[model samples]
Target: MAPEPVRETDPTIGRLVTDASRDISSLVRKEIELAKSELKVSAKAGGLGIGLFAAAGFIAVLAIIMLSVAIAYFIHWAGLGLHWSFLIVFGFYLLVAGLLVFLGVRSVKKVKAPEKAIEQGRQIPQALKGKS
Candidate 1:
């Protein structure tokens, strides 16, 4: 068997430019996808937080109604301590409302900026400049 002659040639400037352009376009599309995914997660968390807040508000309204009933009972407390029962119920409602509000706040706090995507986006300029 005879050895074949090697035929290697440097890429033309136009070819290099086209390849680079294609790579950059692909990178941009991927970045956009990553951002969309991250935003979806944040949006879901925010929605959950809003729902919890609404529930807490409704419970607070119920607590107010209970308080009104307790007041009415107190007005008729002539040697009768029935107002105490209503007062206890109102307190329990308030406690539950407070718990819901706390959970809502925690969920809202969990909704954060897409740090990974942002960091990757920032690196794009450096990457274009041939820097790591």
Candidate 2:
């Protein structure tokens, strides 16, 4: 039986394969880093959202207390005692409530989803290819 000759890839092809593999490995690493960065941004945004809710709740409670005191004062000024003072206090509370609602809505609307890090990471390869 005749011995079969081993076929080898050209050096250029071999180098291309090596380079492609390295490029892919680097791309994978960059994707992982991008995901990590995105996740961190998302976590921070979530934390901010929670904090905003907490602040809104606190402010609501404080507003209620303040409105109560204001009503008492209005009643004393009216010379009608606490009974008639409630109307003025209630109006004040309505204004505060409206303002708070506006602010809360604004804050919620301002919250943005984290930008995709992987998308940005992919651009690097595209840019490199373009430059070539």
Candidate 3:
């Protein structure tokens, strides 16, 4: 007796399921790879942006120093002694810096720990053990 030939057009249920799972897995992997690549580009751009911002901030600081010098020179032109004019500008900057440090310390002292999240974290092991 001759055996029947397998038809390619009609796939078995098991074969279909296997094909579907393989296709889904491939799709998921491709999506993950795409996301990783996109994230890499985004991270590179973000790093570049941060560097540019830092450069800008440094430039701004230089500009501020120049302005401070200009102000001191203006004060000297207005008949104050050059040394005293520079000294006054230096004193003003020192006072402003001290105030900022004081305020920063006060703000930092107000920071509290995350109490609720900590309590929930403590409950995680008990929950896993099936205890309330």
Candidate 4:
């Protein structure tokens, strides 16, 4: 296969090509900025997710410890032929679990997206045009 010859007939064609090149370069820069902004957002989201999961795991372990205490109490009370005392311990466990779940939900609700970077990304093109 032979390579095609390059041709430039009019001055307008040259100007147009230059303008097109500038536009493409501007667009690429804008896209890079957008990607960076999005990556920052994703990183923040991922970090929050990891933190929340860690908290949930900690809460789960605490809940297990509470349940163990309840079991021990149940065994002690049942040994004295009192079954109702076990119910009290079980209820305490339920209350603690419910409170933890409520707190977790509130924490999740407080999480907000990092919007400033995204807004800056949006404004870059306009800033570039003003510079030109």
lDDT (0 to 1) per candidate: 0.87, 0.86, 0.99, 0.85
Summarize candidate 3's per-residue lDDT along 27-132 as a digit string, tens digits.
Answer: 9999999999999999999999999999999999999999999999999999999999999999999999999999999999999999999999999999999999
- For 1-132, candidate 2 gives per-residue lDDT tens digits of 998765675357778999999999999999999999999999999999999999999999999788798767867786976755776677877899999999999999998766687778768888889852
TM-scores, all models, native as reference: 0.52, 0.45, 0.71, 0.50
Q: Cα RMSD (Å) per model? A: 15.0, 15.5, 6.1, 14.9
What does candidate 3 score in Cα RMSD to the true structure? Answer: 6.1
Better of 3 and 4 by TM-score: 3
The TM-score leader among the candidates is 3
lDDT, candidate 4, 1-132, per-residue tens: 998666666458779999999999999999999999999999999999999999999999999878777776767766743455666667877999999999999999999887998998888998989952
| Residue pairs whose backbone atoms clash in candidate 1 | none
Candidate closer to the true structure by lDDT (higher is better), 2 or 4: 2
Give the top-scoring candidate (lDDT): 3
Off by over 4 Å in 3: 1-9, 105-132
The per-candidate count of clashes, in order, stands at 0, 0, 0, 0
